[model samples]
Target: MAHFPVNHPARPLYRVLSGLIGLYILVFGVYGVAETWGDGLFSREDTSALGLRTNLAFSLVSVIFGAFLIIGASRRGNLGHYMNLTAGAVFLVTGILMMSVLQTQVNILNFSMATVIVSLLFGLILLATGLYDKVGTEEHAEEERRRREHPIAEAHR
Candidate 1:
């Protein structure tokens, strides 16, 4: 026989974090797009030094990826959850590296600090949500075991 289960405590927190990250991605991507549009693609230094075209190409790609994250989180699908989390970590690392490079090129303390703060917040959220899920799963399993062992006493009318 098949049985239905109640929501695990971890599930809600995971979904909430997933949704927040999705929104974060979309907002950041949009800002990037606007900045690139006005600034003529990549920063002059980035383009000239690394031969990297940080143009509309990157913004468009980021927008598309962000959209996917939003849809996945909205649907509460398996793949979307994992992808969003992975993307969060990637964003944190990439932001740090980019900020480090940019700091050397430009004396913008505020900009570098903002980037680091955003990355730290996003990474921390992802890490917290992941650990919550793991702990919640184990707790749920233990509760189930206790229920099974003390069936009648734990059962509600």
Candidate 2:
């Protein structure tokens, strides 16, 4: 089983970072929507917003995802942890998939290299935050610390 830190000391910092990323995505989506309003939903035009290429469809999706991240970051329980993990995986997979079709007609999102980079970066950050932001009682934390410190002993049990 995967072991995530419980009661991490830097949980607040991670939360703040994820929140900032969410805010940026939200703002970018709004701007992208305005910039591509008259275009086709999946237009292949070279519309740009916040240094990332986008289309109406992509902008709408971004709005939804950004809101999700914001809500997840605000949660004070394991809900946030699970949400962050899910979001991170989505972002990473999306980035890779988009990058694969960067110059092909399959690029429905009209993703540019910069957009792919940002997606991957956000994914990594969110994944890190999720891994260390688990909430648990002191006893759970102590057990985790002990397990981490004595992996050999733990494996034999």
- Candidate lDDT values, in order: 0.55, 0.93
Residue 67 Cα positional deviation in candidate 1, in Å, after optimal superposition? 2.0
Models, CA RMSD each: 8.8, 1.7
> lDDT winner among the candidates?
2
Q: Using TM-score, give the best candidate's number.
A: 2
Clashes found in each candidate (C-alpha, N, C closer than 3 A): 0, 0
Model 1: CA > 4 A from native: 1-7, 44-62, 105-111, 131-157
TM-score of each: 0.56, 0.92
Tell me the deviation in Å of residue 34 in model 1.
3.3
The TM-score, computed over Cα atoms with residue i paired to residue i, of candidate 2 is 0.92
